[model samples]
Target: SEPFLPFTAQKLVELFGLEAPDWTQAGNGQLLKESSSIGQMGLLFEKIEDEVVEKQLNKLQESKKMNEAANAPAVPMKEIITYDDFAKLDMRVVTVLEAEKMPKSKKLIKLKVDTGLGHRTVLSGVAEHFEPEFLVGKQVTMLINLAPRKMMGIDSEGMILMAEDKDGKLKLLTPHEGTASGSTIS
Candidate 1:
């Protein structure tokens, strides 16, 4: 409830049978007669409450920062994508008809693959682990519908997927026993 004891002159006029005195006209008179001394305690308490709210906001922000750091291995900050978008990738099993070391390039191998549909020439950078002669005639998995990338005057139709070995070398991904070329890899 409000402070009821300290009533203004207008309020006192309605409470007590007295005409309100206009301070400007009554020069010698004071309307409030006396004012309530609520004191500085209320003002000081308000400032303390404001500081507590600020500390709570800071604590919440710190907790958010700690949670983000704890989940760093999960890559939580990466952009979200839909499953339909991932399904758009066209991957197929293709037989490596020929493989050869690229001229002047250390890790690049020019491989000609037979995708049951047609022949596609792709320049894969996986020569470090696979010897061209050994890789030939092997059925390897390739991304068939990838955007064509041109390198050394060759238009690479698709990307040949590879895995990273313990030595940090790229190992060509191949299909298991007897999966013929042009097989749909789901």
Candidate 2:
């Protein structure tokens, strides 16, 4: 039988009802030096500890990256357009003449706005973020040249410009000072 290391002898006795081999009487009658076994075990344990610590650090770094990505913009920047293409947009300042939440919808708001051209109906998906009364008489940016579209049985004449934060909160875009109802926004 091969000579058993001192530590293996104790474990073998505890796990199985087997007698420990006498290392001094085994093949060649030589026992492994206890100091060498202890040193190897210590090195093995140190390697295991290092691997565990590295795994923990990797997990922490991945968690930090996930948090940063959550706070970043939801969409990437759009493709750039030429100056003439941008100039084609009829963006202007408009005053909210009247506002009300649309029927049968939680997100839509029906608004009447003065685009300096005329009073027009603009449907915006902002009812969840803003109250109808809060929008009344507020001067806001509008894209006035968009082809009119029908929503919920109403013709939406333009689109209200809004800003969104990382948390998905929406805010209407407005000028710093009060602007005329129909002022052009260059």
Candidate 3:
């Protein structure tokens, strides 16, 4: 007859959230030697503990670096350019005759601009920063000679000039006062 142990180590196993260790060898009809199995289990637990500690340390370091970057000062200026290089740009004032958001697009707005040469389509990716209704009748500066490119199935004839601030706020570079459309910017 087999002896019955009334109190096994089940409570102790549950206290450490551990499953009861299996003592049988896998699929070989043999029992695993006890002392070697205990050593291997201890090594596995040590590896898991080391990995958890490393992950927590990395997270803490990343958070500290992010806070430091958020408090940093303004960005450094770009490389200098000469006036002769700047003179190559054919900048002109254009009046927005019509503006509307492009269908099926998130960032594109179709604008009909009067270039003094003629009325032309201008596709600007500034829908998130400016409303279409706010752009109508506004005289804005543009680079007139850029090659026409198709964006969202609309032909963009020119590039509208805008100034972006440090916090990603965009402001179109418009005439301080009313200016004639197609007038060259000196």
Which structure among the candidates has the greatest TM-score?
2
- Which residue pairs clash in candidate 2? 116-182
lDDT of 2 by residue, 1-186 (tens): 124465555554444333454555455424343342322222211245888899999999999877986878677879999999999998999999899998899999999999988999999999999999999999999999999999988899999999997667898899999988888878
What is the C-alpha local distance difference test score of each model? 0.77, 0.82, 0.80
Give the number of the best model, judged by lDDT: 2
Please rank every candidate by TM-score, starting with the best: 2, 3, 1
- Worst 10 contiguous positions by lDDT, candidate 1: 37-46
Tell me the deviation in Å of residue 29 in model 1.
99
* lDDT by residue for model 1 (37-115), tens: 3222222112458778999999998888777666546323568778887798888899999999999999899999999
Q: Which sequence of candidate numbers ranks them by lDDT, best first?
A: 2, 3, 1
Candidate 3, 1-186: lDDT as tens digits: 012432333443343344554434225433343342332222212245878899999999888877776776777888999999789888999999999999999998999999999999999989999999999999999989889998877789999999986556789898889989999988
Q: Worst ten-residue run, lDDT, model 3?
A: 37-46
Report residue 107 deviation for candidate 3 (angstroms): 0.6
**Number of the candidate with higher TM-score, 1 or 2:** 2
Error of 3 at 121 (Å): 0.9
Q: What TM-score against the true fold does each predicted structure earn? A: 0.56, 0.62, 0.58
| Cα error, candidate 2, residue 69 (Å) | 8.0
Candidates 1 and 3 compared: the better one by lDDT is 3
lDDT of 2: 0.82
